[model samples]
Target: MNSPVVSKNAEGAYSVKAPLRGIRKSCKYIFSNIYLYVDKNPVYQPLQLWSDEQVLQHQAFEKEQGFELTEFKNFEDIKEMSCDFKEYGICEVTDGSLPDMTYHVSTKEHTLTFDVKEK
Candidate 1:
């Protein structure tokens, strides 16, 4: 396990800030591969259960970025899964064209965020 970069504010609120360093090839890697720890339960994969259209859009975006998006062949596969984020708390995603980016997560106890940068 890796130690996450975390800190507390003057208000006693906690936050986790991780630096993501690498060139992620697809949307799956960007959304699913990254590790998200909530209350130390375990590393969470946010994009494991995405909508069919969401997956298609991701593939299109990846295609535009010169990546061979070859994961799901149809919408049925994507729609079959349900994305339930209740366990992770409130979440917000600032979709970026590039894989290297940042994330800001806000929970009742703390705010978690990560920065993904080019390696």
Candidate 2:
């Protein structure tokens, strides 16, 4: 059999690196598919996943500006929205949105916070 394409290493052996922003882990490609990684372990609920085409579009947009752009797994994460506004009546925190690398969610009238690894 062939050897593992990407065995574990000191920094975790893998050709593709996780996205440095809010994106899902479900959406994927051969490598450099941060969307796939985020789909598995998303910071926000409803787990926003992107298509390979979408990733390409986003990258292309950034390239047009001649600079690396921050990527988000889900569109909701990049937008200014708050699930808490309706769920927990919290005006500050929100759900489906990663704020400063943190995700706030409401469950049974209670809001919870989860730390995330976006990059």
Candidate 3:
């Protein structure tokens, strides 16, 4: 059995080094968030993980689907409505206490969070 090796560095800092010899199993998670915009031009704010081109593409797709992107009064209003775009990453609405509505999604690429202060 190999034991942990301890050594002192030039800075007089002692450290114990653990051996990493076994096969390590790990998990990686990717998350994304959708923010419901409550302004005059209400929109479920696009995610940061999406590129500008992707956003434009999604907008085009939305138009093609005849999905009327309407403004919502609050989080509940958004929750009550249905989303037409799911191919572009918009998912079900989640419950939150923030000023605006918030939605979350998880994928293999990255994680996401929505901020109310962001206009």
Candidate 4:
């Protein structure tokens, strides 16, 4: 099994990819939202939600394979923290709300990195 890859692109978008395996095809599993943690503290004020359409699309893809990929674009809340190497980050994917079946997609101690710009 492959662990989730959490990265910040040059455009400052945060992307998380979690790989799943042995999921039943009949199961209509849906990922409610994603939570980003920096040093054990939540980054965003309000948790991000997956739209109904997005959830459906994700389900469709999961039925064919096993994995969920999500991206957060232009999110100011994570900008500074993502650029700081000293701060470790983690991405969690849950089926319902908190205290539910939460999957820690990223590494146990992953550090965020900024894209280097050549002068």
Candidate 5:
């Protein structure tokens, strides 16, 4: 899996290019939420969950419209930051009776700390 690229444009808005090809293979997990840590503190926000089908459809749309970039136009003066993609779904081995499980596809190490650059 490729690490998500995070950068700040001239306007001070942040953008992230998170590749979903690896997560697409399973077709089981859905995008739950994004974890953003600024200056080592978790930034809380209400992020909606994207269903599995929705994710697949979005991926296809991105393929046609060029690279998919999720932009954050509300943050500035960030000294340090990191991000992680969280997903939730049922296990493949389950017999449709198990509970949903959550997993993290980190961009960096276990801490999900990635290098942020200014443009």
Candidate 6:
């Protein structure tokens, strides 16, 4: 059997040192309030990870007819989406608190926060 070895420094103190950072395996996470749009402007706030699963479901919906999700930085890029919903929407069935409303998209490349401008 191999035995453990102890070493002392110049001060004659022996100790064991542990790693500072890596992998983040045992990290703790706390929830933050996720606000989609605020100030009634064309800008969208940053996305929090708490709702990441919901974002995935949205991508699946777009894939039903064989159209896979394409990541875009702006709301205008979505073929079916128009207007500054990221800021304000003046369309039917569009509301401030729609469960499916997203100014955020989570993708393999990155997560984007939107900033909208008045037209």
In model 3, the runs with Cα more than 4 Å from the true position are 1-48, 70-119
Total clashes in model 6, counting residue pairs 3 or more apart in sequence or in different chains: 3
Model 1 Cα lDDT, one tens digit per residue, 1-119: 24457687896655655332223454322222234433322323343223345556778999999998756432122212222244533333334221212222211233333332111
What C-alpha lDDT, on a 0 to 100 scale, does residue 10 get in candidate 2?
A: 83
Instruction: Tell me the deviation in Å of residue 78 in model 6.
Output: 4.6
Q: What tens-digit string does per-residue lDDT give for candidate 2 at 1-119?
A: 12223334586423422322332466522322222222232233343334455556667989999987655444333433343323333222234423333222211122222232223
Instruction: Give the Å shift of residue 97 in candidate 3.
Output: 7.0
Count clashes in each candidate, considering only residues at least 3 apart in sequence or on different chains. 1, 13, 3, 0, 0, 3
How do the residues 7-115 of candidate 5 rate in per-residue lDDT, one tens digit apiece? Answer: 8889766667655334556663433344443331232222232334454556678778897633321122122322322332212212222212222342231222233
Model 5 Cα shift for residue 73 (angstroms): 20
Model 5, 59: alpha-carbon shift in Å?
21
Question: All candidates' TM-scores?
Answer: 0.25, 0.25, 0.22, 0.24, 0.27, 0.26
lDDT of 1 at 79: 18
True-vs-predicted CA distance for residue 26, candidate 1, Å:
24
Model 2 regions more than 4 Å off: 1-49, 74-119
User: lDDT of all the models against the reference?
Assistant: 0.37, 0.36, 0.35, 0.38, 0.38, 0.36
For model 3, residues 16-62, the per-residue Cα lDDT tens digits are: 43332232356432222222232223335432223333345566877
Higher-scoring candidate on TM-score, 1 or 6:
6
Give the C-alpha lDDT of model 5: 0.38
Candidate 6: C-alpha lDDT: 0.36
Q: Which is the winner by lDDT between candidate 2 and candidate 3?
A: 2
In model 3, the clashing pairs are 31-110, 31-111, 31-112
**Which 10 consecutive positions of candidate 4 have the poorest summed lDDT?**
94-103
